[model samples]
Target chain A: MDNIAGHKSGLSWVTNISVVVLVVLWLIPTVGLFVSSFRERDQISVSGWWQAPFSVELTYRTRGDGEVRPVDGGYVMEGNIFDTGEVRSSFEGGASTVSAFGDRGVAPAEYPAGTVAEIGDGETLQVNADGTYIYTSVEEPGNRGPRVYFEAETPPQFTLDNYRNVLTADGMDRAFINTLTVTIPATVIPILIAAFAAYALAWMDFPGRGLLIALVVGLLVVPLQLALVPMLNLHQRLGIGQSFLGIWLAHTGFGLPLAVYLLRNYMVGLPRDIIESAKVDGATDFQLFVKIILPLSFPALAAFAIFQFLWTWNDLLVAKVFLPSDDASKVMTVKIADDLLGSRGGDWGILATAAFVSIAVPLVVFFTMQRFLVRGLLAGSVK
Target chain B: MAPRAGFVSLKGFYMPVIVQGLLTIVIGVGGCIGYFYLSNLLLDKVIFPAKGENAGRNINRANQIRPWLFLFPAIFALGLYLVYPVVGSFWRSLYGRSPSDWVGFDNYVQLAASNEFQQAFFNNLLWVIVVPAMATFLGLLVAQLTDKLSWGNIAKSLIFMPMAISFVGASLIWKFVYANDADIGLINAIRASLGFGNPIDVMQIPFWNNFFLMVILIWIQTGFAMVILSAALRGIPEETIEAAILDGANPWQLFFRIKVPQIMGTIVVVWTTITILVLKVFDIVYTMTGGNFGTEILPSYMMDFMFRDDGRATAVAFIIMIVVLPVMIWNIVQARKEMR
Candidate 1:
C-alpha cells in the first residue's frame, strides 16, 4: 500500500510538474518583455528580466562643487557641472550628499579639491571646517519629495515612457503611417484581384484554364527576388516604379499567386448545386459570384485578406525594391530596422519598443480577423 | 415552365440558341483561352480595351460579350499587376543591367557561379524539404490527436492561436524566447536559472538557425495544417472506423489501413500546398535575422542584390524562378490529379 500510494503521488506530481514547467517556460520571455519594456536602461543592465520588478540593491553618491568660491567666511563654492536643480527630487529632501567627490563609486578618501558634502536644507545650514556641515534650519519644511537617503528601497514603478518614446520620439509615428499606407493598398489590391481570379478559376471554364492556373502556380515558385528587376523595369516603363503604387503592385503581384491558389481552393468547395441553380436561373457568373459565391466564400476571403494584410504589412524587401528609398515612402519595417541597426542597434529599449510598435497593427488585425479562418468552407463540400 | 417550351418553335429555338447560349459559351471560352495565352497586355485588351460591345445583338457579338463584361476592370487590374510582373521578371532576368546595359547570358553565368546564389539555393532546398515536412507532420499529428478527444475544439483553438499571429509577430514572440539575455528571452532565462552556461544566441546559430527560423514557419503553418487536416479527418465516416475496429484491426492498423488511405488525397493537397509555401519562405528569415549568419535563402539573397544596386539581383532572381518552376509544375499536376 505504501509503494502504491507513493507511485500514484509521484505520477500526479510528475504531471503537475510538467504543466508548471510548460507554463513557466512560456511565461519566461513574455514576463521578460513586460519587465524590460518598463525598466530603465541602467536597471535593465544590472538585473535579468526575472530579477526586475524587484527592489534592486543600488548605491548612489551625491556631490556638490563647493570648489571655486572659497568664501573663507562662509562655505560656498561654484560647482563644476551641477547648477540649480541638478539633484532630482529624490535628493530634494533626503539626507544625502557627496562624500569625497572622487570618480569611482567606491571613491577614494579625497576629491580633486578635497571637498565633501553632507545633509542640509534650504536655509541656515552651516558648513564647518574640513568638509563637514551643520544643517540647522528653523524654516525647513517637512521633506516632501522622494527621500534620497542612501539604501532607500525604490520599488519598481513601471512607466509609459518607453511606449511614449517608441510611438512619438522614435519617429515611428511617420513610419507607422507609412507602413499602413503601403500595406493597406498592397493587401487590398491583391485580394480584390485574387478573389476574382479565384472565382473565375474555380467556376469559369476557359481555354488553357489549367495552364493559366499552372502559370500562377509557376509564378509562385519564381521567387519575388527573381521578379525584382523585371518588375522594376516594368514599373519604369509604366512610370509607377519607386512609387507607392509600384510597391503596392509588387506586393500584390507577389501576394496574388498564393491568394488565388488559396481562394480558388476555397471557392471550388462551395456547393456546386447552388452555383448551377443560380446559373439555371439566368444569373450571370458575376451576379452569381457577387450574390452567392462571394458571400459563401467570406470565410476564405477573410482568411486570405488577413494573410495578405499581415504579409504586406511586415514586408520590407518589396517596399525597398519598388518604393522610393526616400524617408517618406519607407515602410515601418524598413524604417525601424534600418534606423535601429544604423544608429541605435545597441539601444535595446528603443529597438524593442519599435519592434513591438511595428508589429502592433498586424497583431490587432490577426486577433479580429482570425475567427473567419476557423470555419472550414470545404467541410461539407466533399460529402 | 421552360420544360414544355423547349421542344416547340424550332426556327425560333435554333436561332436564339445559336445566338445567345452557343455564342456566349463560345466567346466566354474563347476569351478565357485568349487571356490565358496572349500574355497579359493582349488579355487585358481583349477583355476591357478601348472598344465596348455597344452594338445590338444583330450587329455584333455584343450579346456574347455582355456575360463577361463585368470581368473587365478586374481582368485589367490582374493583367497589369500580377500577369505583367511575371513576364517582366522573366524578361528582365534575361538581361543584366543597372538600366538597359544589357549583358545577355552573363547574368545567368554570374548567378550560376555566385557563392551567395549557391548558399541561397541550398538554403532554399533546406526550406523546401524541412518546412513542408515539419508543418505537415505536426499539423497531422495535432489533427489526429485532437480529433480523438471530446473537448477537442478548445484544444485545437489553443493550438491554432499561433496561426493568427503574423510571421512578424510570431518572430517577435520567439525572439523574446530566444533572446541572449535571460531577462529578455525565456529559453535563455530558464537555461541560466537551471545553472547552465551563459545565454545562447539561438538566432546566430548558423545552419541550425535555418531550422530555427523554419520553426516559426512551422508554428504558424501548423495551425493551417491542423485546420485543413482536421476537416479532412472529420469527413471520414464513423462507420468505417467502427468496421475496422469490428474486424479486430488494432488502432495503428485501423488508422493506417482505413483512415489514412481515405484521407491521403487531402494529405497530398496539404503537403503540396505547404511545399509551395516553402519555395516562397522569405518573411520569417528576412524579418528575424535579415538572412544573415548563414541564413540567406533565395528571396532574401535576391533582395540583397537589389539593395546593393546591382544588376546581378535579376540573374539571381531568374535562377530562383528556374528552381521553383519544376515544383510549380509538380504542384499543378498534383492538383489536377486531385481534381480528376
Candidate 2:
C-alpha cells in the first residue's frame, strides 16, 4: 500500500492538474461573459473584469461652483454641480481618486477658486461638493454647451441592467412567449403520439410492426435540415406557410424519430406480464396504458419530454422558417440569435445574460427530469 | 368482471374506435365536397359581387348545422396544415417552382454534377465518419477511466454541463476564447504571448474549418457518449475483467479484450447517434461564421437555398435525405441487434 501510494501520488498529480486545466478551460469564457454583461460598455473596452478588484484610476475635470456660500475662509462661492449621465457609467468605485477637477477641460493637479477658465463653449461653469453648480451664457453665443470635469472615484462593479434591457427589448418578450407557445405544445404532442406508437410497437401484436419501428429508427438518422426546405415548400403549397400550426407540425415531425426511438426502447423493456395480466382482467388497451404502463413509463416519458422540450425551446431554424418572424410568432431562440448574432453580437454581457436566460428553462428541465434517465424503473419488472 | 355481450365489447370502448375511423372517412370526403362548394360560392360571389337569394341562410344557417361544425374545421386544418405540406414537398420535388413545369431528375442531376455539391457531400461524409468516431472514442476512454473511481460521477457531471448549454450559447462562449482582439479571443492572446505571429481565423480556413466546427459538436456530444457508454460499461461482467487481469493481461490488454468487445454494440449506437447529429448541424456553423469562407456544410447550404427562394433548396434538402437514409437503416438494424 505504501509503495502503491508513493508511486501513484506523483502520477495522480498530473491527472489532477489536467482536470483543473480542463475545468478552467470550460469556465473562463462563461465567466468572462458573466462579468462583461454587468459592466459598462466603455469599462469593458478599457479593462477586463478580472482586474477590476484591484485599484482603478479615473481622471476627469471638475469646477469650483455650487457653493453659493459666504464661508469663514472663502467669503463667496456660487455654482451648481452637474453630471452628464454618461460619466456615471464609466466611474469605477473604491480606492478611486480624482486626478484633476476644473472648469477648463484640462488634467491639472490643482486649480484655484474663482478662476473662470474659458472652455471652447461660450458657457462658463462652476462646481462644489454638495453637487450644486451652474453654467453662465457667454456674450454672443450660438448653440454652445458648458464644459466641466471632475475626476470622481470609480469602483470596480456593475449592475444587471443589461439583462433588464435585453429581457425588456420589444422583440424578446414576444419571442419568449412565442418560444413557449411553440415548444410546450410541440413537446407535448410528439410525446403523446410517440407513446401510443411506442406502446403499440412494444406490446401490440400487429403485422409490419417491426418494419414500422425500423422505419422510425431509420428516420432518426435523416437530418431535419433535409426535411426543412421541402417542408416549407410543402407548407406553401398547402397554404399553411408562416403560421403557428406550421411550426408546431415542424417541431412534431422533427421530434418524432427520437421520441419514438427512446420511448419504444423503454416500453419494450416494460414487464410484459403486467400488460398481459391487464388483458386477463379485461382492462382495455387504453385502461392498461393509462393506469399501469403510463405510470411505469414515466421516467422514459420524462426523459424524452426534457429532450424534446429543450430542443424545441432552443430551436431557431424551424422557428425562423415555419413561424412568421413578423411580430406574432418569433420565438426566443430566433429573437436572441438576432440580438446576439449580427452587428454588435460581440457585447459579452448581453450575450451571456441572454444566453443564460435561454438555457435557464433547459437547466430546470434537466434538473427536474434527469433522474428518469438513469433510474432503472423497469429493472425488476421484467426479471 | 364485465363480459362482452355477443358482438358488443365491454363498455363499448371499441365503439369510439370504430366511430373515429368512420368519422375520418366522412371528414375526408365531406372536406373535398366542402372545398368545391366554397370555391364555387367564391367564384360566383367575387366575380359577381352580388347577394344570393339564400346568402342569409347560407352564412347563418351554415353555422347552425351542428355544434360539431368546429370538428370539420379541425379536420380541414389538419388536411391543409399537415398532409398538404408533405404531399406538396413530394410534388415540388418532382416539378420546378409553381407546380406546373416538370423538371424531373434535373435538380438531382445538377446537384450530382456540381463540385460545390460534391464538396458538401464529401464534407458531410467526413463529418459522419469523423465526429462520431472521435467523440465516442474519447467518451469511452473518459467513461472507462472515470468508472469505479470515487470521483468519476463528479467528472462526468462537470463534463456533461456543456450539453446543458444551448448551441448558440456555446458558440458565443467559444467566440470570446477565439476572439480577434488581444483582450478578446483567449487563444490569440495566448498565441501572441507565446510569440506566434498572426492570429489564425479558426472558423474560416477551408477543409480544416470543418474540424474546428466539429470540435464543438464533439465537446457537447462526448458527455452524452460518456453517460450512455458508462452505463453499458457497467453492464460488463466483473469476472471477465478479473479473469483477464489474473492472466498475463495488462491494463491496455484488459481494456481492448474485455472492456471493449462487451460494449461494442453500445459504441455503435452512440456513434450512429452522433452521426445523425452531424447530418443536421446548423446552429454552430450559423453562429460561428455563417457558413462563409469555405465552411459551408449541408445544413447551412440548405438554409442558404431556403433564404434565396431557390429551386436548389428543395434539391439540396432531398440530397440530405439520400445521405441520411442509409445511416438511419443501419441504426435500426443495430438497435434490433442490441435488443436481441
Candidate 3:
C-alpha cells in the first residue's frame, strides 16, 4: 500500500504529526486527574496539576513569641517562624525558606528575606531565608507578640494520604467489595446461561430458532431504562427487593441479550465437519456442548466475559436502582456519584483518588485483554 | 451467621461481603452446571433409556425435547427480566402511583405538557445526532490516519483507554478540566494565560453546555468507533485500492471516493450503535450537572420522577423505547439479510 503512493513523503509526515496530536488530546484529561490524585490538598486547590513538579510559593502568617530579653540597649525576641506549628503544618514537604517578610497582612512581602527594616519608635525587624527573625524595640514587646508574615517557597510533594483517606474513612473499601460482589456473579452467570442457549440455537433443529435469533437482535438495542420500574416491582413481589441477590439477577437478565447474541454468532461460524465428526462418535447434544463446543468457543467466551465484567463493574444506574441504598451495600460507582460528588465536589484530591480507584481494575483488564475485546467488538457489531 | 460474624470480627467490615461474593459465585456457577448436567442425565437414564425395549423411539423423543432443555434457563431469565418488563412498563404506565388508581393516558398527557420533559427530549435529540456523528467521524479519521503508521497499535490503545473508565469517573475527570476556577480548570487556566479577564462556568452556558457534555461521550466512544472502523478499513480489498490509485485518484479522492464507500456498512453500524448509547446516557448528566442549566437528557429526566412518580417514569421509558424501535427494526432486518 505504501509503495503504491511512493512519492508522497509529505503526506507521511502529516500522518505522523496528526496521530501525535490526536493521541495527546485523548490522553491529557486522564493524565491530569491521575497527577492531581497524588498532590496535597492545598496544592491542588492553589495551582493547576500541570505545575505539580515545581515548587509552589505561598504566603503565611505567624506570631514571633520567643522570650523577650534585654539586648543592645533594648528588648528582643528571637525564634524561627518556620518552627511555629501553623507554618510547619502549612508547608507539605521538607525544608521551606522564607522569601520575604512583613509585619502587616496587606503588605506581607514588603521586605526581602535577610534584610532589615526600620519601624516607628526606633524598632528594627530582620528576617532571614532560614526563617529566623530578630525583633528589637526600645520598649519591651507587648503581651501578644508581633505578628510576622512571610512568603515561603516549599519543595514539590506527593503523598498517598488522599488514597488512604478515601479508602478508610470515605467507605470506598466497602463499596469496592460490594462492586465485586455484584459483578462476579453477574458476569459469570450470564456466560453459562447464554452458552447453552447459543448452542441450542446454532446446532439443534429447533422450531423457532430463526425468530428467536431475531428477537435477541432486537432486544440488544432495547434500553434497560424500561426495565427499571417493572423490574423493581417484580423483585419486590419475589421478596428479593434491594438485595445483592436482586441486583445480580437484574444484571444477569440485562446482560443476556449481548451474551446470547455474541456467543451464538461465534458458534454459528464453527466448522461443521468438526461437530459432525463428534456426532458420529456417539456424542449427545449435551456432551457435544460441554466437551466440544464450549472448549472451542474460548475466545468468544473470554470476549463476552470481559464485556459483562466491565459493564457490571462500571455501571451506576443499575446498581443505584437494584441494590440496597445502605452504606454497606453501595457499589463504587454509586458511592462516588451520590456521596463523593455531592459532598466532596470541590475536593479534587479525594474525588480524583476515588475515581482512579474505581477505574483502575477495568483499565488493567482492558489493557491485558484488549486483543480479545477488539475481536469481540468486531464480531458482535461488524458481522 | 456465626461464620460471618467471626469473619467480620477477624478481618473488619469488608470480610463478610467478600465471603458472600465467593459463596454466590460458587453456588451460582455450580448450580447452573449441576442443572444442565442433571436434567440431561435424567432424560437419558430414567425416562428414555438408550438400552433394550423401546430404545429407538425413546431416543427420538429425547432428541425432540433436548433443545428446549438447553434453552429453558436462558428463556426463563430473558422472559422475566426483559420480555416481561417491556410489557409490564407499558401496562403500569396507564395507572397512577397505585394499581387501583386508574388514569389512562394521564401520565403521557402530563409528560407532553411538562417543560422539563420537552427540554430533555430535545436535548436527547441533540445528543443522538451530535455524539454519533462526531465520534464516528473522529474515529474514522484516526483509523485512517493511523492505518499505515508504525506505532498505530499503541496510538489506538491510548485512544481506546477511556472505554474502560466508568461514566462517573470520566465525568469527574472532565469536571476538573472544565472547572469554574481559573487556577484549577485546565480550560480556564489556558484562558487565563491568554489574557482572559474572568473565568466562566463552562457547564452553565445555556445552549452550548450540551455540547460540552457530548464531548465527554465522544471522547469515550471514538475508540470503539476507531477499533471497529479500523478493522473494516483493513478488510477493504487491496486490488480495489490499487486500481483507484492507478486511476489517478488523489489522496482525498482515494479516501472518500474509494475507501469510505467500501466500509459504509460498518460506518453505519458504528453510528447506530453509538446512537443507541447516547439515547440511554444518564450518568454523565446525572453526575456532572444533575440536569441543571438545560443539559437534561431523557434518561436523567426520567430518574427525577422515579419513585416519586412511577407513572411518569414508565411513561418516559416507553417514549425512549418508541424512539429506539425504528433503529431496532433496522438492526434486525440487516442481521436477517446477512444470515441469508
> What TM-score does each of the candidates earn?
0.73, 0.76, 0.96
**Interface RMSD (C-alpha) of each candidate?**
15.4, 13.5, 2.8
What DockQ does candidate 2 score?
A: 0.14
lDDT for each residue of candidate 3 in A129-182, tens digit (9 for 90 to 100) = 988889889887777667888988867789899999999999899889889888
Comparing 1 and 2 on TM-score, the stronger one: 2
Please state the CAPRI-style docking class of candidate 2: incorrect
Model 1 alpha-carbon drift over 4 Å, by segment: A1-35, A59-61, A64-103, A106-154, A191-210, A213-221, A258-289, A376-383, B1-63, B66-87, B148-155, B164-169, B194-200, B203-206, B244-262, B287-291
**lDDT, residue A207, candidate 3:** 85
Once superposed on the true structure, which residue ranges of model 3 sit more than 4 Å away at CA?
A: A72-74, A89-94, A102-125, A137-139, A142-144, B1-12
Q: Rank order by TM-score, top first?
A: 3, 2, 1
DockQ of each: 0.15, 0.14, 0.60
**Which should have the higher TM-score, number 2 or number 3?**
3
Docking class for candidate 1: incorrect
| Residue-level lDDT tens digits of model 1 in B10-49 | 4223233223323333443455445433433342355445
In candidate 2, what are the lDDT values of residues B238-339, reduced to their tens digit? Answer: 788767766757666777987899888778767766776787778887888787767778887778767564467767776766666677566667656655
**What lDDT would candidate 2 get against the real structure?**
0.63
C-alpha lDDT of candidate 1 relative to the true structure: 0.61
The per-residue C-alpha lDDT of model 3 at residue B340 equals 83
| Model 3 per-residue lDDT at A140 | 76
For the candidates in turn, chain A alone yields TM-scores of 0.74, 0.77, 0.93
Comparison by TM-score, 1 against 3, better one? 3
